[model samples]
Target: MNRRELREQIFMLLFRVEFNQKDDMPEQCTLFLEDGDTEISEKDAAYIRSKYEKIAEKLPEIDKLINETAIGWDTQRMGKVELTIIRLAVYEIRFDETVPTGVAINEAVELAKKFGQEGSSGFVNGILAKFA
Candidate 1:
């Protein structure tokens, strides 16, 4: 898979965290890879898992940043899909040096357009742009 495809997979995997318990995520992640609609290379799967875990590990910090940046729109009140996209973008912006801030924001906007409500992309771009 290409970088965008792998990021999509990582987004999908990270999306699962909002629904499943911590204890169930290991199995869920495995099932997500094994039962996905498209086949990904083992290396790609490993990359997705690692990036997902890294983002998961930093969720508290991520949310804190969002909470501070977004005024009244605390994470608990944000739409789940929007929050997930924001989390992924925040990780790329703050933790992953390889991703330029502009690319991260753009990708998050793309993900929001794909998976979120009609206005979600605008909301995502507004929030992420503050970081850039």
Candidate 2:
């Protein structure tokens, strides 16, 4: 899968975090991979899992950044979809060196448009714009 596809997959996987307990993530991730609409190759699956894990690992710091940057919007009070997208973008922008900042913000907005409420894209763009 391409980077965008991978990001989408990661986003979907990460979305589960808001709904499940920390201990449940391993099973959740495995079930998510097994139940995907399209069959994923072992290599892509591994990549997705690793990247998801890395993102999950950094979520505390990511959420911190979000809390700091988006005034009046803590992770708890934010919409689940927007919070999830912001978490991924924050990780990419602040942690992942390979992803250009523009690409991270743009892809996150795309994800927001695809999975979030009608105004999600703009909300995501507005929040992300504060980062760079």
Q: State every prediction's TM-score relative to the real structure.
A: 0.97, 0.97
lDDT score for candidate 1 against the true structure: 0.92
Error of 2 at 81 (Å): 0.7
lDDT digits (tens) for residues 90-127 of candidate 2: 88998889999999999999999999999999999999
What TM-score does candidate 1 get on C-alpha atoms?
Answer: 0.97
Which numbered prediction scores highest in TM-score against the true structure?
1
Give the Cα lDDT of each candidate: 0.92, 0.92
The runs of at least 3 residues in candidate 2 whose Cα sits more than 4 Å from the true structure, single-residue gaps closed, are none
**Number of clashing residue pairs in every model?**
0, 0
How many residue pairs clash in model 2?
Answer: 0
Query: Which pairs of residues collide in model 1?
Result: none
> In model 2, what lDDT does residue 118 have?
97
Clashing pairs in 2: none
